[model samples]
Target chain A: MKILQVEGLTKVYGKGDAQVKALDNVSFSVEKGEFIAVVGASGSGKSTLMHLIGGVDRPTTGKVQVDGKDIFTMNESNLAIFRRRNIGLIYQFYNLIPTLTAEENISLPYLLDRRRPNPEKLLEILGLLALTDRRTHLPGQLSGGQQQRVSIGRALINDPAVILADEPTGNLDSRKSRSIMELFKMFNRQYNQTLLIITHDEKIALQADRILTLEDGRILRDEAVRA
Target chain B: MWLSKRALETLSQNIRRIVDGESVDLLDNREGPLSILRNDIQTLVRMKQEQADALRHDKERLKDSLSDISHQLKTPLTSMMVMADLLETAPPEKHAELVRNLQTGLTRTQWLTDALLKMAKLDADAVAFNVRKADAREIVARALEPLNILLEMKGQDVRTAGEAELTCDVRWTAEALGNVIKNASEHSPAGKPILIACGENPIAAWISVTDSGEGLKPGQIARLFRRFQGDGTAGYGIGLPLAQTILRGQNGDIEVDGSGLPPHVAELTDEEYSGATFTLKLYR
Candidate 1:
């Protein structure tokens, strides 16, 4: 099943003289459980593309259908609710609450939705990330890798329909990066989570099922790594 | 007294079923000591079922391995028999060629048996790996050393880059890497360079060989490392499985990715296909 369909997405930042085309009519569809890597250098619109799909920023001229629902067509409040319920976003910087414990940080999504996270699922996610022992520790006390793992747990707490990660491992050393990648692989293989990661690193991109190269606000090439 | 006797009788039957490696479903939803006993019995039954399933899976795998190994040996054996039969009535002019053919066949058969025997030993936990800290660079060099003659003959080039210090059974790791490099060379076209690179992520010290040949098909990945499974025509098919066995013995693994990389990863202007990469990793 195709879970995501991006059609004729074009995002222009400003008016005539300072007009910047961040994304230029990009179109692609992602299947329900694909692990896709979007690669490009800086200013390649990869981030813009992610923001648009995440419904954080609406496209200037196009649509994004996620799980048969056109996310862009929804009103702002509807999109916010839709994104919170379906989209899990992880960032390069951990973006965790400074004073919140790892467990508390992971429970933020549920807290925002005015619902409590299932205790069993929260424990399982923590254990999967090997963060059970450090669940009580604040983000300030955790290492870079541990912080990222917590962020991953937060993303996964809702069992979101799709995971949108941008430069997830950019802040960590190679060793930490490998461990994080293994975590991603385990989720992909075991749970069949639909994941789309944007990275500039070719080595990291190689682990994904397919690679979409972005250049100058346009998709240069899209190729399967393991069809 | 009658109810207690019946309960004991049912419990005995469940124990017997478990002893026979059969699944037992005990129906006791009552909230009492009897229910607790039933809960424990249910857990045991689940464990027994899992064990039986695992044993069946193992047996199936063993059967497949045996069949594959026999097939590998049979090919060379059939060729050897035909050549021997020709030797008996061959003219003098063809005698040297026929003898050489027999020698080649014998050597190939010998190598196959030798590799299989080593694998069997590894599987049996007989070989004590002498682990030590070794330079990834030296290991790559050692792996490529024996391939020099064969690669030169095949008109292939190898490019080695990057380095990391890895703690492994240096000699055996070199042996395992050599197998992967050899597989890569076999698939690569003439004049194309096989790329070998090594580096470390915090969790692992690694080496990878990317061949500039046809990559793996979608279904091929599942069986790519099994015994006697190779890209049908090129190899006797022992190398990858053996490499996996060796690395796994040392707390490591091998990953093969032939996903169509653009021109840069394994590009030669003349070739239309991207090469697959086999990475040998030893975790830190």
Candidate 2:
């Protein structure tokens, strides 16, 4: 099933003279369990496109339907709840709560919903990420590689449908970056999680199941990887 | 010419090092030229400052570029996370694990982006507070409220004393106290007593969470709030730093007395020594 659909998406900021087109008439669809990468230069509207699809920002003209629901149609309060329950977002700096341990960070989504975290499932992900031993430590204590793993666990805590990562390995060294990508692969293979990542690094982008290139607020290319 | 002269001076210093313990000094001329050389050294320092100023400007520009790149990556990653999360709730079976992983991965990325953003914001001096009069005891309760279940689950208890009312930002103060209490709850074992006391001293309003956990060794006391510094754990090492940030933002502070004050723990049970106690102070 098509998990995400974006049609005629255009995002414009400011008015007439000062206005900038962040995304212009962009359209795309993503399949379930696909690891996709959106690549673009600094000025490209790729990030803007990602924001529109994520429901973090509304497009000036277009529709983005995730699970067949128009997110922009919802109110801000509902959107916050929806985003928390459905989305898992990761970034380069590993935004685990500074005070929360690995376990707490992983369980944050569920905790937000006022539910007890599933220890069994949490332990499983912690072990997979090799963070079981460091479960009690704060984000400040973990190595870059370990901290990223905790972030992965936090995203997984909700068991959300899709994971959106932007330059998840940007801060790590090559070794740590590779290991993080490997973990992404492990998740794709083991759990069949749908992933859409934004990356500047060519190697990182190439590893995606599909590549979508954006330039000057437009989609330049979108293609699946060959076996 | 000036650059060349400085280079020559540096060359002579290297040559002096090579002179095998001889009484060699750059300005030690037999003509009593030390005073003149000192004046020249002062002039060189002034010249170097001008050059260093230019380098500082370049460094700031590079730092700005990196910050921009980080934001560029972060903005989209956040959106993608929302999209992935929305998609995760789709079909029940076809790509369950894939969906789970995507959501998880996205969350991880989002967190990292948040830290970078916070760091950038801190660097940019964008983290300002709206400090006001508030209650200290109430703030502690509010921060501890979320973790009440966890405390209960661990068979732990918390008590408070002193007037709850004081002056500070309710949210920021709560956040600081939350960190201290949460740290105590997580590090110490179950069925132990964790005490949170709030009172006003002559200097500042004090709030302290004393846990009956293994006390910190002399080593852990130092480098306590350093970022990414932890005792082999999964955290990003930002709690104490963040607490410090929040407290400091409110013109308050946090400290640790791995050897905390007495009465706070004199009658404590044996299980309470596994972790250390932390105290926070804020202005009235």
Give the Cα-based TM-score of candidate 2 against the true structure: 0.44
For each candidate, what is the lDDT? 0.80, 0.69
Candidate 1 to truth, TM:
0.58
- Find the 10 residues in a row with the least total lDDT in model 1 chain B: B262-271
Q: Worst 10-residue stretch by lDDT in candidate 2 chain B?
A: B23-32
DockQ of 2: 0.01
TM-score per model over all chains: 0.58, 0.44
Please give, for residues B74-121, the per-residue lDDT of candidate 1 as tens digits. 988999899999989999899999999999999888988989888888
Docking class of 2: incorrect
Candidate 2 residue lDDT tens string, B1-284 = 12356746774674465345332223221112332343234324333433555477658755764755566566657766676766667675646665666677677677656655665565455877666667776787789887899899999888655564557778767866776787787677789878776666333566777876776743465455655564555445555666776766665666565644433333333333445667676643
Structure candidate 1, residue pairs in collision: A175-B201, A175-B202, A175-B203, A225-B259
lDDT of 1 at A222: 92
Model 2 deviation from the true structure expressed as Cα RMSD, one decimal place = 28.6
TM-score of chain B for predicted candidate 2: 0.60
